[model samples]
Target: MDALGFSENLRVLRKNKGFTQKDLSDKIGVALSTVAMWETGSRRPGYKTAQRVADTLDVSIDKLLQDEALSGGEYLSENELYSRITPKTRNANHDLLEIREVLRTRPEMKMLFSVSKGATKSDIERAVAIIEALKKDRG
Candidate 1:
């Protein structure tokens, strides 16, 4: 969104909450001119103040930054998707290794041992392909 768009959005939210610029400034512990500058598109709040405004407005920081529908909805940008998935995927991979270790000593997996113990060429190729895809998709 443009600066003017951001300004308008802030003003609308403040008005909807029945707050004057001074009232919002007081609530967020900012100077009145800071709020005025934001509303007039002459300046923007710093990250800290932006966060406070989002909290005070009962909105997410992402929503306050961008007024696009996707910003408020389920869609994530490529960078956002990567940032969100990286740690989660790494943790899950660690858990999977632990499961593999546990299964190595489990009698219940004996019947499936032959299939798992001897990897076919196709199985190896598929695993490589999956790894390549994951690497390619990571941003």
Candidate 2:
């Protein structure tokens, strides 16, 4: 892990959030010198302090530590995607879970099908058509 890389990312995020070193230190209850040291890569913060900084900056600890990974847009290979997905998708899964919850509560739009019994052939076909239409719109 590159300490300088992490430091740069932390600095960028802090500035983007309009926080001076003193502002960040005050928010996270650290000394301004400590924040300055961390930002300059002269020293690293402890795990707890690092987490506090991340929280105050509204970024994940992994994101703070591995800034390079977050900045690139290269399409990942299968194994790369699998490894990269775990932590990143933990946040995404929370969003997906909320979507699932909302979808569960939503009344069936396909009233033509008896959902209780199971989707009929026409219902499946219609659902597929709806999905294709949505895909087209998105594209």
Candidate 3:
């Protein structure tokens, strides 16, 4: 198993689920320090323990253990995506929330055509501005 990948994935998943280390430990009946160690890749859990953690996180064991650089493609979790698009400034999350709303309303609309895989922050912001402009015109 890719310990580093697992740790990063676990951190992302835990945050997305709005669980602090203490909360996750409580859910999985583990110590808070255990969760911290897992997130740091300092320790590995047994198979049964890993399965329990996976189940608690509502993710498969494979997802928890797989390296991100699979043959299919690189896996970018939601947190990774956010970090790529915006570096967690105060307004970045608000911008992302608005962009997510646009995406929800227009799922078929592709933002960046040429570069579909790893879009930069400016690319997303530019696309969103265009979309919002068009929306304003229509309204």
Candidate 4:
């Protein structure tokens, strides 16, 4: 896991979720400077803090630790994967490639894709809403 890669990933994921560093700091119960340091690659959080960041960003720890060497590859972190999986991304032309990459990397979601295949648009909407509700409940 590259520290720079981790920092970059954190920054991108936070921005994607429409959160500023201060908002993330507040939510993760960390100092604003601490978040800044982490994002700047000047510091790294402990396991607990890392977990908190991951949970807040709705991503797995592994996503935050992606190898920098693979940055140019087709690999998409869980954060990017979920972003592309969202309904809003469904209409984006680039999202189709992302969705395919996600399915290739995360076999578990294959069932989700298959189940939603023949379903109405409303069914997908309801499912997404349920998932969002579940996330809120967990948080």
- Going through the candidates in order, what is the number of backbone clashes in each? 0, 0, 0, 0
Query: Best by lDDT, which number?
Result: 4
- Give the TM-score (vs. native) of candidate 2: 0.52
Candidate 2, residue 2: how far the Cα is off, in Å: 2.0
Global CA lDDT computed for model 2: 0.78
The 0-to-1 C-alpha lDDT of every candidate, in the order given, reads: 0.77, 0.78, 0.78, 0.84
Local error of candidate 2 at residue 23 (angstroms) = 0.4
* Candidate 2 per-residue lDDT over residues 1-139, each given as its tens digit: 4687778888888888999999999999989999898878899988888899999999977768763533444444657645766776778888988867766676563343345248777878888899899999999
Q: What would the TM-score be for candidate 4 when compared with the true structure?
A: 0.51
For residue 100, give model 2's deviation from the true position in Å. Answer: 16
lDDT, candidate 3, 5-120, per-residue tens:
88887888888778999999999898999999998999878889988888988997767776772334577786764554434653876887887787777756444443555778
lDDT of 1 by residue, 9-99 (tens): 7887788788999999999998999899998999988888888998998876655666443323355576874575568777987998987
Query: What lDDT, from 0 to 1, does candidate 3 have?
Result: 0.78
Query: Which candidate leads the pack in TM-score?
Result: 2
Residue 83, model 1: Cα distance from true site in angstroms: 11
TM-scores for all candidates: the values are 0.48, 0.52, 0.50, 0.51
Winner of 3 and 4 under lDDT: 4
User: Weakest 10 consecutive residues, lDDT, candidate 2?
Assistant: 108-117
What does the lDDT read for residue 120 in candidate 1? 88
